[model samples]
Target: MFAGKRILLIIGGGIAAYKALDLIRRLTERGAAVTPVLTRAGAEFVTPLSVAALAGEKVFTELFDLTAEAEMGHIELSRSADLVVVAPATADLMAKMATGQADDLASTLLMATDKRVLIAPAMNVRMWQHPACRRNAATLAADGILQVGPNEGGMACGEYGPGRLAEPLEIVDAIAAALGNGPLRGRRIVVTSGPTHEPIDPVRYIANRSSGAQGAAIGAALAALGAEVIFVTGPAEVPPPAGVEVVAVDTAAEMRAAVHEALPADAAIFAAAVADWRMKTARAEKIKKTPDGLPDLALEENPDILAEVAAGPDRPGLVVGFAAETENVVENATAKRARKGCDWILANDVSPATGIMGGRDNAVTLITDEGAEAWERMGKDAVARRLAERVARALGPVGAA
Candidate 1:
């Protein structure tokens, strides 16, 4: 993978700068030719000599250097690469990118370039949590900029939370995904995950134990296989994977709308365990329990996202749904696939007896239009990979588009 691909690497100033050196080696090992660009601050953390030595080429830094510009103008260098990646993206640079401030050479090239940009953010936990950073991140995501890490853990500032750069291997994988150009290269996929909450009152709501792990894994696996994935998930236990679109939702109503908006994709996987019913009329204010018996509340049905998408004119080439049943797993799931107008359904027994619900391992039965195939219990990661491979094969291969 990534053989002969040209990658423009922008190393930002941060303690994680050394990780970029390893990232360079990983990319080159995969046969990717890398052009390392160091920011003014980036040079403070890692020297150009070391970077150039490892890259086997001159490291770019200055915008006004006479000879460097003659051979590779900032204008030319900016747009030459297939993909541009920034590891250890600091708060200042993120701000510059957000506000279109091209004052420095790195910022200038970034602004001038039309290449697809991927940034692995690294900052203090407080800075990452600031409203300003949130707004900037949202703006970048909306503009189609990709993000990887700043994963949750102990930080450099002796604090703990989400602000560490993703590991080098993960970054390399993200770069490979960008340049893969596989069969699903340009194809879009929508995946729904986790269970939704239905509010009963201001202080309480009805929910489930779903972790959203399976659906999120499916989205990542699909992205790795070369699809542009739109992952809409309810509150989940696991972090959604990097290098794909993510939409977070809390309620069944929100999940329904998101799915509709992300439709017309080449494929869809409805893995979310959306609530079947919601409070007919939830109290605006929290209802205080009284000595008197509590009032009985009416309930209403929530939209069936799977059925809606499966029946729509924008239905994908493959529409796969999940059936997390307590009993009659295959019999019921097969019926669901047909009723929902979908091509395939992955059903599993999630009864109290299965021990798979809310667990890392899963035992799924793949139900298709033709028949059902039972699979042994395995980690959700393995299941996702196998399922994604099946999707690729059924639709014909990574280069089959």
Candidate 2:
């Protein structure tokens, strides 16, 4: 997809800097020439020799190099590439770019570059969530500087949250999307991600252990496939994909509403683990802990978004629903597929013992009318790419597939 493309890579300082090397190799292997610019902090993590070797070009680190500048000025260097990519975009660099801070060569190039920029952030969860960092990221997104991820998982801090950089394959896919070679190219896809939050009171809510990783990954994969993605997500721990339209929701009711509104997609994937039940009558304030006993809670069945979409008048050609099961995984998934009237069911075990739910890796069984197709344990990227291919095939060509 990247044949003969020019990719200018800006390597940032973060623990995930090592992953950027793989990114460079992948891009270069696909006939893309990479020009690497390593930040000072980035230098601490990777050697210029390694980066240059993989990129097949000299690594640039200095703001002023008379010899190099004599041939191509900084402005020319920045504009020479078809696109600019910042991998392992540390919190410092993101903040700097967000505020237009040009203290160093990396930030300076970010400020000076006219080409579309893609940043894959890698940082501690706290730093990524800090109001300051959040503000900067939001500002950058609003400006249309492309972004890929800071996925949720274990971080270098030994703490876990959403500040991890995406894997090499994911970064490559985003590059493909940016270059307009996405699998679902020119096709519209709707995806639901995360677990819906059912509020019990102003201070309390009922939710699940859904980080929204799977659904979000699917969205990114679809985007890479060249599909116009509409991501309607509930409250998830992970950051939204960069290049698509995202609609945020909370309760299952809200998710259903959003799903209905974002209809007529070429394919709709209900990957969200929407809460099946909600409080029938939630108190306006926090329920007091009484001396006698705790207040009794009432329950109500929530609206079924998957079934609704499957049965809706504007239902897409292919409707895929997730059967996240703990017991009788495949059996329940097949039943759910039949009951929901959806074209596909992706079932996974979340028995707490399986380490699947809210985890980085998944073992899923694809249930279709034909039969069930089970896969061995694999990373989420593999799952997403394989699932995306099936979607493209099922849809018949994104616009027409």
Question: What TM-score, over all chains together, does every model reach?
Answer: 0.69, 0.84
Regions of candidate 1 where Cα sits further than 4 Å from its true position: 1-4, 69-72, 154-160, 180-184, 194-205, 209-225, 233-267, 271-273, 280-292, 300-401
Per-model CA lDDT versus the true structure: 0.83, 0.86
lDDT of 1 by residue, 304-367 (tens): 8888888888888899999889888889998888888889999999998888888767999999
Give the range of the ten consecutive residues with the poorest summed lDDT in model 2: 392-401
Best candidate, TM-score-wise? 2
For lDDT, the strongest prediction is 2
Backbone N/Cα/C clashes per model: 1, 13
Tens-place lDDT per residue, model 2, 111-132, is 8888989899999889988999
Candidate 2 TM-score over all chains jointly: 0.84
